[model samples]
Target: MVTTCDIIRMMNRISQYRQANRLLVIMPTWVGDAVMATPTLRALRNLYRTAHITALTRRSNRPLLDACPWIDDILSAWPPQIKIQRDGAQGGVFGVVRRLAAGQFDTAVLLPNGIRSALTTMLAGIPRRVGYDRNGRGFLLTDRLAPRRQLGAFVPVPTLDYYLAIVRYLGAEHIDRTMRLFTRPEDDQRAEDLLVDAGWSRQIPLVVINPGASFGDAKLWPIERFAAVSDRCVDELGAFVAIGGASKERPLLQKVIDRASRPIFDLPGHGVDMKVFKSVVRKASVVICNDTGARHMATALGTPAASVFGPTDPAWTETGVAVDRQVRVDVDCGPCQLRKCPLDHRCMTRINPQMVFDHVGELVGWNDELKHKGQDQDNSVARSVGYS
Candidate 1:
C-alpha cells in the first residue's frame, strides 16, 4: 500500500529526528544508577556528534558525572525550592517549563521511569520525548518503549543494560558497555595526602572496607565481622585497612574501628566528598563493601572489589566486569529485594569474616610471608573460621 515517495518521506523524517542539535538526557537519582547511565550518555554523544548534550539529574548525583567529556552541561533537577523564572517573574513549575522551552531542545531522553520526569519534558514541549512506557507516563512520551516481558512479568534486566536500551531505541550505534568514572587531580592529591597522614606507606597494599549501606540494615554485614576481616587483612597480608562510607555512616565506621584489633583509617569521619571518595577507591588495592554505590564506583574505576550481597539480587546489580567479585550466602528467603528483613537476618550473619578474607585474599594474591606477623595477635577476638 505504501508508495515509493511515501517511503522516501518517512526516511527523511527519521533522518531529521536523528540530526537534532540540542538534546537533554534525564539521569537517574541514585549514585549507582547515575554511574550506570554513563555508557548510554556516551552513546548518545557519539551518535549525535554535533548535538549539545546536557544531563539533567538530582543535585546530589551531579558529582558522579564530574569530568565526563560526553556531557556539555549538568543541570540540577532537585532542590524544589530553587525556582527558574521567565519574563522577570518567578515561574515555579511553569517557569521551569518555560525555561526549558526556551532552550528549544529537539529531543529529551528520560532515563528515570517516574511520571514527574516524563511530565517535565512533555510540559516543556520537547518535540521528541523518549522513554519506557512504565509508571503510567506512556501518554507523555512521543516515543514510548515497552520493556521486555516474560511469562506475564517484566523481566529484571541489569540496570546498566536497562539504561542503555533508551539510547539504543534512539538509534545510537557502537554502544560501549564499559562503565566510566572520572576524578579531578586535586581529589587524587587529597587522597594521597590522606594516605600519607594515616601513616600508610606506598609499599603496603591498601584494603578499603565500607561497613554501611543506605539501602537498609538488612544489606549490611555485621560490624563485628567487618572488624574481624579488617584485622585479618592487616594481620595476614600486611595491608593497610581503611573504612569509608557516607557521612551518615560514621557511627557504623566507629563500631568497626572500636572492634578492630589494629588501627584503621576512617575516611568518612574525615569528611571525604564523593570526588575524594572516588580518588581513594581508584588508588586502593582492593575494596570490600555492601551492595551499595561504593562497590559500583570501585568496579567502574577498574579496582578489584569484593561486593557483599544480602537481600538484594546480585544479577540486578552485576557489574558485568571482571574486576568485581560478588559474595553472598545461600539463604532460603533472600534476594527478597526487601529493604528490611523480617526474620533473624541470617543471610548476612552467616557470612563470616574468614569467608570474606579468603575471597579478598584470592583476588589480591595474599602474602603468606606476613602470616607470621599475625600469629601474636589475639585469636579469640572473634571466631575466624568454620563459617558455613
Candidate 2:
C-alpha cells in the first residue's frame, strides 16, 4: 500500500548504485577548473580502480581532459560552438541536458556548480547527481553540499576540498586532499627538447609567461606589464622566457616577445596541444601568468608560479601549491564577476608591473631584491579560482 511518490523516491535511491562498474564525471570546462578537477577524478579512480571512467567537458578544454590519466573517456556536452552558451543562454541548458540524457550515464558529479550542470545530470536521469546546493538547481541534485562559508582572505582554500565535499555527501570518504597531475616520462623529455630548441642552457632558470585570459577582462593583466617583466627577467636574472598562448592570444603575445631585449620564443597560434603544454609547464622553473588555466597547470607540475588576479576572485576556487606568490590590484569594486569591467578596470590596471616583478622575485628566490628595492606590497584578485 505504498504511494507512487514513495515508490519513486525508493527507485531514485536504488539508482545511485553503480553496479561496481562504469561512472561518468562532468568536469568544469574552464582550463583552470578542469586542471583542478583532476584531484576529484583521481579520488574516484582510486576508489573504483576497475570501473570505466568517462569525463564530460567542453571542446575547448579537451586538452586538460587528455592530460588527466584519471579520465578514461571524454564526452562533449555540446558542439564546440554551443559550449559557452552557459554564460547566459537558457536553451543551451536544455540542449546540453538532452545530450547528457543520451549518454546512459548512471551517476554524474557536477563540479562546475552551474544551474545547467545539475539540470543536465537530472535530465540524463542520473540517479545520483552530486554537486553544491547553490545555483538554484539544488532540487535536481540527489547529493547536494552547502558551499563553504569562507576560507579567509589570505589563506586560499585548495580546490580539492571543495570538490571532495560534494563526493563526501554520497558516502565517499578517506580521500586525501593532495593535488597531483599525471604525465609520461616521454612528455618530460619533450619539454626538455622544447627548451633545448629554444637555445636555452640546461642549468639556467626558465620562466614561462602566459598573458592571455579567457574568463573575460577580469583575470587578464596588461600585455605591456608582461613584456616589462620578461625584459627584467632576461636582462637582470638571466632567465629564459617562453611566451605561451592560443592562436587568439598571439597578437598580444607577440607584442610582449617583440619588446624583450633577450631571446624569447613565441609558440602562439599553433595549438601546442594539451599534452605538450603540460610537458612544457613541467620543465619550467617558474611560470608568471594571469589567473587562467596555465597558472593551474604550472602549479600541478609542482613548479613555482606568480599569479596575477583582477576581477575574478581566487578565494572560491584557489588550489594548493608550495609557492604563495601572487599579485593583484584590489579595488573597491573588484571581483565584480562581470565579463567586461563596468568601471575603469582599476583592479588590473592598478596592479603595476613592479608589483608582479616583486611576486616573481619571491617565487624565484629573489625576495632579497624586493627588500632592497623597497617596492609596494599588496595582494590581488577576487572570487576564488585555481592555481596548479
Candidate 3:
C-alpha cells in the first residue's frame, strides 16, 4: 500500500511530464540583469508560442518590460504594489507565495541564482522549477544546471549567456543573442517633448550623459568628470548635452550643470520612467554613462555607447554590441566587486574624462577629424576595456 508521501511524490513526477501550459518567470533584480534576461524571455516565447507567461520583477523595472510583447503579465515583488509591513517581512514572502500559488503556474523559470527565488517557487508548488543550482538551493529546483565555475569560484561569463542557459535546457534554439527593448508611443512623444522644452532640435547631435549610478558610490565615476565631458561635447562637438539621473539622483545632475561651462539639459526633475528613458536613450547619437543600466539600455537599442567601469568587472556584461565601448583605470585592488570602497577608490579616480571621450569620439565617428589633427588614439584605458 502506497503512503500519502508516496502519492505526493508520484504526483510531482507526473506533473513534471506535463507541458508548460502556464509559465512564471522570476526576473533578475538589477535593471541591467533584467534587460539581459530578455533573450531568455524571447526564446521561451519562440519555443512555447501559446503559453501564458507572467514575469515577477521588482516594481522599478516593471516599466522596462511593459512594452514587451512576449510577456503576458508582469507581477511586482516589491512594495506599494504588494505592500509589506516592514516589521513583518515574512508575511510579505508568504503573501507572494499565496499569489503565485493562485496563478497555478505549471513551470517556473528562475533567472536569478538566489536561493530565495528557488524557495519561493518551490513553496508555490510549481511542479517544474528550473534554475542554476547554487546557493544551497539545488533541492528546490527540479531541473538544475550547474553554473560555469573554476576552482569553486563562478566564472564571469556574459550575462546574456548566463541567462540564456536556462532556456536552452528547455530545448530553446535561439542563436541570436542580441538584446532588444521596446517603448510605447507616449514614451516617444514624451522624449520629444522633453527635448523641445529644452530647446533641442533634430539638427544638433544629442549626447546623453548618465551621471548617477544605482549600484552605489563605488560604481560612480567622478561627477566633475561628467560635467567636463558635457561641456566639451556642447562646446567642441556642437552637441546638445543632456544629463540623466533618478529622482533621488537629481542633485548629482544639478552638480554637473553647476560645474559645466556650457548649458546642460537636465532630465531628472521630469519624473522619467524606464519607458520614457528608453526612448531618450534610443534617440541619442551617443550615450556616455558609468557601468550601469543605461549601458545595457543603449546596447539593447543598438545605440553607440561608452561606459566607465570602477570596482565591477567588465567581463560580466558582454552584450555582443560591436559599437559599444568602455574604459576602466587599472588598480591593484580592483575589480574588487565591492559595493562601497574601503580605500581611496583609485580605480575610478585615475580615469580622466579624456580617456572616456576618446572611446566616445570613436563611437560618434570622430575618425576623420582626429586623424586630420594626427592625434594618437592610444590611451591607458585602451589596454583592457579597449578602443580608447
Please provide, for model 1 over 1-388, each residue's C-alpha lDDT reduced to its tens digit, 9 standing for 90 to 100.
9999999989865854567689989888777777788888889888889899888877767778888889899877542223555443423556556667887898998888888778877888898888899989999988888998899777878999998887777787678776778888899899989888888866677899998888888899988889998999899889999989877778888999999989899887787888888888877767999888887777666566787889998877665665577788999998788888899998888888888888888756522222334521111111121101
How close to the true structure is residue 220 of candidate 1, measured as C-alpha lDDT? 91
Candidate 2 structure lDDT = 0.70
Which of candidates 1 and 3 reaches a greater TM-score?
A: 1
- Candidate 1 wrong stretches, greater than 4 Å: 1-17, 79-99, 366-388
TM per candidate comes to 0.87, 0.78, 0.86
> Cα miss at 149, model 3 (Å)?
1.7
TM-score, predicted candidate 1 vs. hidden true structure: 0.87
Error of 1 at 182 (Å): 0.7
Q: Which stretches of candidate 3 lie over 4 Å from their true place?
A: 1-18, 78-91, 366-388
Could you give candidate 2's per-residue lDDT for residues 99-187 as a string of tens digits?
A: 66666776777788777677667766777777778768889887777775566323345666777766555556687555556566676
Q: Which 10 consecutive positions of candidate 3 have the poorest summed lDDT?
A: 379-388
Q: After superposition, how far is residue 82 of candidate 3 from its true place, in Å?
A: 12
| Number of the top-ranking candidate, with TM-score as the measure | 1
RMSD of 3: 7.1
> Would you list the rank order by TM-score, best first?
1, 3, 2
Task: For each candidate in the order shown, give its overall lDDT on alpha carbons.
Answer: 0.78, 0.70, 0.80
